[model samples]
Target chain A: MTATAPQALATLPLADDALILSHRLGEWAGHAPVLEEEMALANIALDLLGQARALYAGLAEVLGGEDEIAFLREERAFRNCQLVEQPNGDFAHTMVRQLFFSAYQQPLYARLSPVLPLAAKAASETAYHRDHAEQWTLRLGDGTEESHARTQRAADALWRYTGELFQPVEGLDVAWQELAEEWHADIRDVFGRAGLTVPEGPSEGAWSAGAGRQGLHTEPFGRLLAEMQHLHRSHPGATW
Target chain B: MVTGSAPAGRHPREASLTQLAGSVPDPELPVITLAELGVLRRVAEPEPGHVRVELTPTYTGCPAIEAMAADIERVLREEGGAERVEVRTVLSPPWSSDDISEEGRRKLAEHGVAPPRAGARRAGPVLVGLSPTRHTHPAQAPAPEPVRCPNCGSAATELLSRFSSTACKALRRCTDCREPFDHFKEV
Candidate 1:
């Protein structure tokens, strides 16, 4: 059966989320703090890129070709959440950002697994991503005082962007409030074990910051998109 | 597991289509055929001279799948003499290393990647280092299984990293041989 518009619309944000984050993670390839981390980040980036490809291919049935949908889109036309578009600051910041996002993704995918076949497969991969983030969260949070402080700062800085994760998106079957609660509980538990406190303040409400699902993004996304689209845009219709 | 067998009165062309599609080698793991890897889920023909093949990816993001799909179409048209070919990817009941055929496992080990131990599915949340959130029921937590070294045939190996060159493999170091090898990780 042909794809419906709502199905395409429902998947666009998720596709953008994976695509943008994949590019961000790929930026750490040669520059990660350690060799193992370099491989780890690349592997995760590749996984996200794969998810984006499948989502875009599915979208192509309703939208257009995958390459055009990915590389040809204007910055204002993108649908990625601001959380994913944020610059990966430092190793601590990257890990905290990863933890927050993966924590939300794992549960979100789990809930969607039964209804969405792609989500079921992605849920398996996201479980590993969550575990990787959780493991690092513990290591950085419980290490030396300097490491703990750095991670704490990163967590606090990124916490505000997470409100967008649980905001209800059209054509998705997830219970937004339930997902937010599960994500909050999981993060709180991990933080408590690491001797770090969940940063105080509202996570989601009328004042929470985000509108990415409507194709709005933060400032850094334009620069990131430019860098990502440069080669493809320059060599239009070129193939290796 | 659609075998290349024609029913009593069925067209021989349909069976050939299944055989041709099943014979396509995985682009990434060339040693094993798609049929051996359990990725070739089904092969059928809606009408004569038109073939449709279904495949599942070993990992959600395996980059080789598009290439593999293209290869299937090429092989079917060039070798199997099909006029029309379509490759569909299905994700439900998602692939596991356990889906690897015994022959596939043997080939993988020969290629220096240790295949997953039989019947082991990755389960439960992986606890981080020094965390108090250990699994409450001891029975539910299986003891860590020893990964036999593909190079030395020794079971004395340690996991170096969960991530490797590809999503489906883990880097492991053999204690006995001092050789690092890839373990075809169970998803």
Candidate 2:
């Protein structure tokens, strides 16, 4: 709407990542154990959707008025990180993913706030999201043996992917490094309180990960894209 | 319409204030003006040379609410509609997408965001179809109907993500054109 010409794949993953997660969270909407949870996840889903729209819209502008890029781009063309792509295995797994991602995101968004316009605009909602995840983690982790065991398994399963959060993208490194340094202490403190440990760094210490943030995606991405775009691709302009 | 003349002693300020206050659009959907959203409940002269506008959100937890209130205050103050702008949040009678103007829907579609659907008439329980993961609940009347994409106008749109970047829409992609657009998720 603001009318900036669309840029290259520069704004690729951030918005797309949010968009994908929004879709995932939506999967849990009415299915959550309780009505309150159902509403909460649905609320979370809506928030992510909004974030995706703004990012996609911005990306479209940057790409020189290519509105199709937002809707019509192929699967490999999407750049969302893999952590979000993993299935929501169970409530515990869902909480773990949220905890892991929210922990990283709180600081990431906080640091990115000064630089990214939309990040600043989205600060409060992100803060609320972080708070919600932390609250749930503490509830599930500190509860019964089953809850605790599940939470632990969830954490362990997701910890492997935590390293990817630090592996910087091309234009993202400068901001990512600064953010890591700035928020390292805070991230650790929060994790400590929730009985969650800061995941150990990757021994390999490589950042390649093969161009996800640059529109090059994993194999599953194509399937996800196919399902996501099926309706649009099939019917074309068929309206209600 | 009283022509530009103020009642003998007053300045013609409230008129200018209303015009300026009217310029601020709904924060979430920027196309239709807030006035049309029924968000600007009133512009009144509670005191001499002072005008107040009562404002409310379309949804209780809509993220843009705080910003919208601030925007209202800022815009009104800038345009001199009121020396002090008071934004009141009224939640008793919650807002419905039906409140969105016809023009508002057009604007949203033009911007590539689908308009809110007419949600009530065709369904069983209101909440059933909006969410598909609920197996515990029995089958209900099919979801009113699939929502069409505004971009390519495809009714074959699939509910891709129940959550979008904000908390009020779902990410639905048109199956026909593979174009993903935002659907104002029915609450």
Candidate 3:
């Protein structure tokens, strides 16, 4: 079968997560504080891009479409949540974003290795990303007074978004439910290790930004699409 | 984990799968096979003639995994005499530039992409009593002697962007040929 069928991909959740995070990371491509850091962030972005493309390609195969998910859908068709879709703020904000997301991601990936192939791959890369982010967090959080204060501010600003990372989508099967439970416990543990205090804020209900798994999204997605799709949309099937 | 191997001509299928799967050259960097590159970490034959090969990416975002997986399936099916090949991505051991084999590095260099020197010192100076400009110094430093221009055989070249078409390379322009080329960024 070609890439045009409409079958549901098994790894859509992971694919969506990768897609959103890659977009967020790509925003830092040229704007990092240091050149080496720039390279490192770009490398991480590429990793996320790799995961996104593979997952999307797999999704396309299941969905049966000539266009990959990035190219084919309206904004609402995307399944990624708002936290990853939020604009990356300053370096501190970016690090906080990295810290918060990887806290959830690192453990999720660790638990997934024996059970799933894609999860195993995500877990490995995320382990590196987690270490990278955690190091930065401690450096910024416990270092100089200014950096510590700023990191604290960043944490406060971004803490509101953390709840949604573990919030399960409605359609998960039993295996996914079990995985989500493990993900919750594992993520909380990592946060505790990072010296981050888990907020007891109200849970951001499903699709407050809309149901991402079911392809309901918010306003920001349109702008993201325009930039992401500009080349492919402008060139019409052009190959690099 | 094989049992009952009395037949004189029979080899454990897991061993055969591992051997075959490991022998497949990395599509992007061919000097190393998946086994040598650490891309293929393990293989299992849970059922007869159906092999499951586990792989890891060389970089967090290496695009070659898909191609590698396809290639792994193709190579294993042919060599192992298997009806089915299941290639799985194992991400627990994240790939680092360090993972590339010495042979792989040589091949990459021959391919005009400079490979990372083993345990090479980082270009950046550490914090404390270091000039902020220290980080800026290396960008202007002269390209090393063995730096062959991918566009021409001239070693006289100036550094451009450290990141080029991909993160693995840098942009450089040769003075002798006056041609800009991508130098596989030495990790």
Candidate 4:
């Protein structure tokens, strides 16, 4: 392996995070609350999938083919954050999840933008995603008592997994503390405006209950992987 | 590297090949040529009769890229009389709405998709805090510039949705004519 091999390996989890989330969001096609929303979610899913493809393609030289890495990998071999792999529970849950993840992604991409051109492009896309999630969070949180309660619950439930997003990856050069702080401040501000409270708990520190960077995942990930890989695995060497 | 092929001795046919490849219309937005859309990054002949074209997708997951690449290759081989065509996708210096040529913008407006507003590039520090923090300060997002209605040419419009039919557009409604239209969102 070349010296840059580890750097390519580091990108796998980031790519997987996007890939899995794209699949989850894609599941909402034709199932979103409205036609516009359906289009919106699918568009977002497509963007994530695009980012994943680019990242995977960048690693092609080091990791063989992008398809082989994305489709053929076993559950234990896949690297992705637990947050993205969590099931999309409801509209509220999905929106909350999107808000948290996009908020983290926006800043993370911004920091990486200088060194990685893909990050610059992904940063722009993530800006829209973060805005979409924040808008929904506000609408849902302040709209109705039922909506507010549901979104609030979703926010609280998903907070734990967010810490993992701030964890340092091997190749990425980021100030984890600053990223975590910015993420926290952004989430707090959005939640505050939406009439929701930021869930206070253990900060995203060394002791966080996540090893997704090391290939460990939550319970729901295996099923998600199965569905994602089923078609690709079944039709090996198939061309469209 | 072939020693015979020198930079100063580039074949005259190479320029025509570049022009031919660049003239291919984007599969999705037929109104704009690949050159206008800035998707056609570079066209070169590494050796005689072998064309290499580089392209960047407008959006990360734009499905049209495969078709666009195929179209480029087909055109070069069948029409341009090239022996081989290679199309590459480059992500660095990622494509921006700003990359849309003046002609592309005009064509997009003519086609009823509002082109991105000039000088509306999303650059600068994004302030995420509602309250001032040590690293950042409270700042509201910049308001979107007025997108003139592609149909009626009215600036009175309201954003209905941040996303539209395609990944590159946002849904907006013209207040004057009451027509919902697509605004080519600034990336």
Q: Give the per-prediction TM-score of chain B.
A: 0.83, 0.75, 0.64, 0.82
- Could you tell me how far off, in angstroms, the CA of residue A174 lies in candidate 3 after the best superposition? 6.9
Higher-scoring candidate on lDDT, 2 or 4: 4
Q: What would the per-residue lDDT of candidate 1 be over residues B1-187, giving only the tens digit for each residue?
A: 5444545665677777777777888787788888778888877888877888888998788878888899989999999888999899988888876678888899999999998776645563322221222211212235356678999899877667777788887777787898899888767
Instruction: Kindly provide the TM-score of model 2 when superposed on the true structure, using C-alpha atoms.
Output: 0.56
Clashing pairs in 1: none
TM-score of each: 0.89, 0.56, 0.60, 0.90
Give stretches of model 1 more than 4 Å off. A1-8, A205-208, B2-12, B120-144
Q: Give the Å error, residue B36, model 1.
A: 1.1
Better of 2 and 3 by DockQ: 3
* Residue-level lDDT tens digits of model 3 in B1-187: 1112223554466666677777788786676677656566677787887888888775547788889999888887777788898888765544445566666666665676655544312321111111111212332233233456654566676555444566455555677887666555432
Model 4, range B22-130, lDDT digits (tens) per residue?
7788787899888788777777888878889888998889999999999999999998998998899988788877788888899999999999866545553221222
lDDT of 4: 0.80
lDDT of 1 by residue, A139-233 (tens): 88998899899999998888888998988878876788888888889999999987788988665566666788778888899899899999899
lDDT of 3 by residue, A1-240 (tens): 112222255456666777778877878878888764676577778877777765665556556543557776667667776667767778777887787777676665555555444555566567556656765666666567787677767767666666566555443322434555665565466456546555455445552333555565556767888888788788887886
Candidates 1 onward: DockQ, in order? 0.46, 0.06, 0.17, 0.39
Model 2 chain B: weakest 10-residue lDDT segment is B121-130
Query: RMSD in angstroms, candidate 2?
Result: 15.8
On TM-score, the leading prediction is 4
